[model samples]
Target: MADIIESAGVVLAYGVAGFAVMALGYLALDLVTPRRLSSLIWTERNVGAAIVMSGQMIGVGLVVAAAINASEFQRGLGVGLVSTLIYGLAGVIVMTLVFALVGILTPGRMGATVLEDRDGRPHPAAWVQGAMYIATAVMLTAALS
Candidate 1:
């Protein structure tokens, strides 16, 4: 039916918008961290970096998911997309601030704590930071809900 096709188009548009926002969130994260995430995780085989990256990805995903689900798209596709973008950007900013503040509060340099590889052995702090990021995302999403 034409209605079904139109609905599908709307869904597709929403998905595209969400993913674009998520990519921007990742870029913001890349800017905040000292090391490049893709290299640290893929090339270096750094478990600690991977852990932190995982948390960040999930956190950003949560924000994107929340925005897509909660936005005023039902009012109209354009309105919904714009609202979702606004929410997603806000989430990214908030998460970045959380990361930065926590990084500062932690005892050592942020990069050192996150990319802790000594003789290829990972440090405990890396995991702790990862969990904190996840917790921040969870709390943020819940608050937004």
Candidate 2:
């Protein structure tokens, strides 16, 4: 039906917007880390890098979902997509700023500490940093909603 096709189109548009935002999030994380994020996770098989990246991606997804939910009904599809993109980007910026702030407050660089593996295991700092990203996203999601 025409309605089904229209709904599919909206879904596609939202999907593209979400993907673009997530890509930007990845780039922001890459900028903060000491090494190339892709290389660290893929080539090096680094668990710590993987954990950090996973957390950030989940956080971005939550923000994007919240944005779409909040805007689609109230503002319609076009505004929903735009707001999702904007909110997702904001989430990335906040997460990056939190990373930097943690680095400053902590004894050593947060990024460097998170990426460290000790005795073939990920450092505890990695878990803490990863949780911080999720927590930041939750707060941003609340603000969006």
Candidate 3:
């Protein structure tokens, strides 16, 4: 019980820190770009922001998991490698489901605003972000249990 509580606290701390870092990245980008450029790229910029946030969250989660699972986290290199692959595959599937569900439920323009490219193609960075999420999940699962 105490271990679970401690682990939760660590996860919460990591999550908050990750969010702060993501916000800083967005602020920096906004400050560096001209107003006109910012207006033009606002949508794509938000997408980038989302990707950055996702990476940060996963990175933080991995670190937190490592710290929390230090004693029982001995899965060896083989387990680590396998978990990475499995988590990555699961992450891709989960991401796809999110996209599909959003598309089905939301109205067109609003959906577009939430996330979309001018050309209607999905962003490449989504895949990269998904991999990070998956990798973190894999590491956490192996380490925690």
Highest-TM-score candidate: 2
- TM-scores, in order shown? 0.88, 0.94, 0.33
The predicted structure with the larger lDDT, 1 or 3, is 1
Roughly what TM-score does model 1 have, to 2 decimal places? 0.88
Residue-by-residue lDDT tens digits, candidate 3, 16-96: 543443344334323432333245345456553355345534644454344334422256534543443344334334433
User: Candidate 2, TM-score vs. the true structure?
Assistant: 0.94
Give the poorly placed runs of model 3, Cα more than 4 Å off: 1-75, 109-111, 116-145
- Rate residue 7 of model 2 by lDDT: 89
The true-structure Cα RMSD of candidate 2 reads 1.3
lDDT value for model 1: 0.80
In angstroms, give how far residue 30 of model 2 lies from its true place.
0.2
**Tens digits of per-residue lDDT for model 2, 45-138:** 8899999999999999998898788765466777778878887888889999999999999998888999998776998888888899999999
Worst 10 residues of 2 by lDDT: 67-76
Q: List the residue pairs that clash in candidate 3.
A: none
Measured by lDDT, the strongest candidate is 2
Candidate 2 or 1, higher lDDT: 2
